[model samples]
Target: MHIKVKFLAYFRDLFQSREKIIALPEGARLRQLLGSLCDSAERHKAVFGKEESLSPHIVIMKNGVPVQNSGGLDAALENGDVIAIFPFIGGG
Candidate 1:
């Protein structure tokens, strides 16, 4: 299956692009895609946490909607789904 993944803001720089299409086995979960995307230790730590789990500080959305209501990291992704990754931001 193929899904579109987008990395926004600082994540884009980390991934070295804003978006890309990734191929995964059918029934792939959000964590699979994340693990495949953040290959390096630096990228992995930035996206995933010290515990190797999706960082709570990072914002993840599925097809324009937040994934928290959809099972979060375990969310089952379907073909053609769009996953957007955004780093946490704070400004005064």
Candidate 2:
């Protein structure tokens, strides 16, 4: 299954791109896809917290809706699903 992952802001620097086409196994959830994408421990922690929890400051959307509202990282992803990920940006 091929899914589209989009990186916003600093996340692009981490993934080395603004978007990528990720090939995931059948029945793969968001967590599995994320784990595969984060190449290092630091990068992984930045996206998914310790114990594989989604970071509070991180924003994740599946198909334009917040993932938490749609079953979180446990959400079932179909082929060609679009995932947008990035840390919440704040301005003062």
Candidate 3:
């Protein structure tokens, strides 16, 4: 499946590319996309942070709302889904 992915904040800086069309397997989730992105980029370390650890504050939205646990990135993705990857914001 193909989807539109937008990186924000640190992730965007790491990617060096604001947006791109990524191709994934039939079923792909937010988490899986992160993994793939990291794998495909040299600066992935800066975007994903600690190895094997998903940033707790990282926010991933599908269409418009938060991904329901994103099924841990194993979520099924459909064609043309706009994935907005944003950093968790704090107002304290």
**What TM-score, computed on C-alpha atoms, does each candidate reach?**
0.90, 0.91, 0.73
Model 2 global lDDT (CA atoms, 0 to 1): 0.89
Computed on alpha carbons, the lDDT of every model, listed in order, comes to 0.89, 0.89, 0.72
lDDT of 3 at 50: 63
Off by over 4 Å in 2: 90-92
Clashing pairs in 2: none
RMSD of 1: 1.7
RMSD of each: 1.7, 1.5, 2.9
Cα lDDT of model 2 by residue, 1-92, tens digit:
99999999889888889999999889999989988998897788788876778988899999998897778889999998999998877789
> Which residue pairs of candidate 1 clash?
none
For model 3 the TM-score comes to 0.73
Task: Indicate which candidate wins on TM-score.
Answer: 2
| Model 1: how far residue 10 lies from native, Å | 0.7
Question: What's the candidate order when arranged by decreasing TM-score?
Answer: 2, 1, 3
Off by over 4 Å in 1: 90-92
